[model samples]
Target: MPTEFQKRAGVFVGLVTCLLLPMWRSELYCYTVLCCFILGGTLEYWTAVYSRVSSLQDWAVYLILFMVWVLPTMAALHIYGGVIGHTRLVECLIIQLVVGDSAQLIVGRSIGRHHVCVKLSPKKTLEGYVGGFVLTFMYGALVHGWSPLNISVVYVFGCIGDLYFSGIKRRLGIKDYSRILSSHGGLLDRIDSFMFAANALVWKAFFFSPE
Candidate 1:
């Protein structure tokens, strides 16, 4: 197993490549990469739950398939259509996924005294959450000029989504979702927060757009 530093480095490198390559490439490339992520994440989630819950395996498979796969794909399609009229939406999403989550992990490990949810994720702390929000919001504001409301919405929902999946893993009694990403866990482990944040972004574009 890789050390904590090694794991963090691995995740950072992978996130940068996956996020920037498609963004700098083309819309079709972005769509293809997003689709692949959604599919892989769905499979990872399903696999994580399969052996743990024998009685609900069938239903869990379908539910994760929809939540992890279908929903994200739909949101990606909307984001791709220039819903926000800015290609920076993809960059913002990546910021939320990479910076926010990474900050939480690093800060939580360094000086995380107050546990946010000891049962679901023992290592999580209030300080870590705050650090993540600050870092994520600053980066988003600089890169995409995201409003306060946008930053708050995505941060809150992303944390919620991450905790929700953490609860699932706790229930299943698994350390990581899968070994697909080595020390980083599974694809779902990486993008679980993005799934929920993407949904919120889609809703914001549709129902709350000033245009």
Candidate 2:
């Protein structure tokens, strides 16, 4: 098994590659990358939740499919063309996932007595969530603008999304989604928050943006 530092370093490298793709490539390329992630995450989710063929149910499978695949794909498509466009949106998403999540982990470990959901993710805490939101809000405001509402909404949904997936993992009795990223777990674990936040942002952009 890789050490904690090695795991974090690997994740950092992956994040840097993801961030550079949009800046260096076209919107289509970014979209393609997003599609790949959505597909990969979907498979990982299915495997984690339904480890055996007999454990799968029709409704549950469909729901998982929609949530993990369809919704994120729609969000990715909209994000590719929304006012912010794919590049900028992806940049912000990466920042929220990387910086925001890092803050959550650090703060949670250092001074996190109140667990947000002890059963789902014991490492997560209310203090960590607050710290993450503060950092995320500051970063978003600095980069995008003083869009407090948008920042708050995205951060909230992101945390919820992370917890949602964590709950799934706990229920399924699995440690990580997969060992695809070595000690960092699967792609789904990394992008659970991103998928939810992207969907919310795309919805806001599409139906609520001012002309």
Candidate 3:
């Protein structure tokens, strides 16, 4: 029961992922994939944000903020040659983004109990947020290493990032960004969590991590 866009995107993602995982040895491999995701994510966000705007100042401000915001986040996630040379850091974040958001939405819609933001996204509940956090926290335990502090920070930021963009949806006066995906909204609609999650993880890994 997939929409045409979802079906196409799903197949393409599967194909690319299958091919890309093996070539993770190359820095270019992971960078290319993450770059596509960032571009797509930013585009969806831009579309959602700009769709309702009628003012030039609003458009200019949003454009500048997006470039200022998203690109730097993607750059931070790219693990180059060094300790993380062979690490599939960027891919790991993207994977979690796919799984984490999808699972949270399913849970939130079906049985979520507490409300995240009753005004912006009434569907988001505390249970869904908790559920998503628990899932991603476990993943972060593995991905962010054994540091308790790092794991906590990553979880908090990931959830906050999702909520942050939800505000953008409210500002733009739209729901789901677009109807392109049957279950999902748009690319940015989905990857908003990754936007902040990746930056938080990178920051923790470099500066805030335990010695």
Model 3: which residue pairs collide?
114-125, 114-126
Per-residue lDDT of candidate 3, residues 1-211 (tens digit) = 7764475468449745664454466676666766776777767777666667779998987777677567667567554333234353544454456546655766676788778677767788888877766766666567545355655555567677877777777777777766565556776765677667667666555664422
Local distance difference test, per candidate?
Answer: 0.73, 0.72, 0.63
Which residue pairs show collisions in model 1?
none
lDDT by residue for model 1 over 107-208, one digit each (tens)?
A: 878888899788987888999999888888888788767887788777888888888788878777898889887667887787778777766666676777
Residue range 88-123, candidate 2, lDDT tens digits: 566657566876787788777778788868887888
- Judge candidate 2 against the unseen true structure and give its global Cα lDDT, from 0 to 1: 0.72
In order of appearance, the predictions have TM-scores of 0.84, 0.84, 0.72
Candidate 3's C-alpha runs over 4 A off are 1-26, 48-50, 77-95, 106-110, 139-146, 178-182
The superposed Cα distance between candidate 1 and the true structure at residue 80, in angstroms, equals 4.5
TM-score-best of 1 and 3: 1
